[model samples]
Target: MNTRVNETERKRIAAAISVWENEGGAPGQDSMHHQYGRRIEADHSWTIYHVFTGVPARFGGDAMTGLSRMDATSGMLRLNLRNAERRRERIELSSFRAVPELAECGS
Candidate 1:
């Protein structure tokens, strides 16, 4: 990927990690009780990938609020956002094979 895209993905991953680390506690800790309010669980490996490549990604049950990478390769990272209801369940890249479709012209 391009340098600019990679850099942006790196920043996104860094921000996500910062949120996760700053929250403190293990991966499934009760972030709500903490000072930060809610802790965003981040995958270390995935974060690293995003830092290197600018691949966009969205994992976890609640796709709306899941973590996203900036590039395609970064999406290969194995950090799962996980589902809110199903705490044990993790959203993997393989599961999301359908890419978004482009808008049609003058529909």
Candidate 2:
């Protein structure tokens, strides 16, 4: 089944979890881990996944493009940072163990 919603509508859902705080929306929060996934085109898309609820949400992306005059929302899946090291345990590379700190403050 293909779940689809207008991008504008999807943005409203994304705005809730969006890192960027808006006028009236839930501010972003620190997560044990992040989740990501994308569905077929013309379908509901979300990058954030709630493990407990079993529902996913979009991470949201750049509002606009300067060159193309186009708007882009985040569709790319993000690996959850929580237990990130454990996830990389299988890999031998030491660099994968490093997790970047969030530089932004949530409202």
Candidate 3:
């Protein structure tokens, strides 16, 4: 069952993930959306993890259009660092902006 998702759908799914994160997850319960993604070395990009499985999708980089399509099975996707540390500080998934670590480079 290989379902082909277009760029629009990928962005839509990404938006859903964003919304799920912004709402602070499910009511009266803690949501693990924080583990959804982290800001990569690039600006405005992130390696977004699967909403339920926490697996990394091909979608990453260039927040606007880099999101990859979703397949029916996870085997078709790629795996990234499950727990990427952010300059010794935990990255808040809700904010996909560049991490403070990058700021140090310019200083």
TM per prediction: 0.26, 0.19, 0.22
lDDT of 3: 0.40
CA lDDT of each candidate?
0.37, 0.35, 0.40
* Full-model lDDT, candidate 2: 0.35
If the candidates were sorted by their TM-score against the true structure, best first, what order would they fall in?
1, 3, 2
Q: What 10-residue stretch in candidate 1 is worst by lDDT?
A: 31-40
Query: Tens digit of lDDT per residue, candidate 1, span 40-85?
Result: 3354222222222333233453222233333222332224232232
Query: For all candidates, what are the clash counts?
Result: 10, 6, 1
Candidate 2, residues 1-107: lDDT per residue as tens digits? Answer: 23455776788878665534211122246343333322222333222334355344433443211211011223221234423455566453444344333222211
**Which one is best on TM-score?**
1
Model 3 Cα lDDT, one tens digit per residue, 30-83: 233234432222443334545556555444542222333232122222222233
Flag regions of model 2 displaced more than 4 Å: 1-37, 40-47, 58-77, 81-107
Tell me the alpha-carbon RMSD of every candidate: 18.1, 16.0, 15.7
Q: Measured by TM-score, how close is model 3 to the native structure? A: 0.22
User: Cα miss at 48, model 2 (Å)?
Assistant: 3.6
Query: Where does candidate 1 stray beyond 4 Å?
Result: 28-107
The candidate, 1 or 3, that scores higher on TM-score is 1
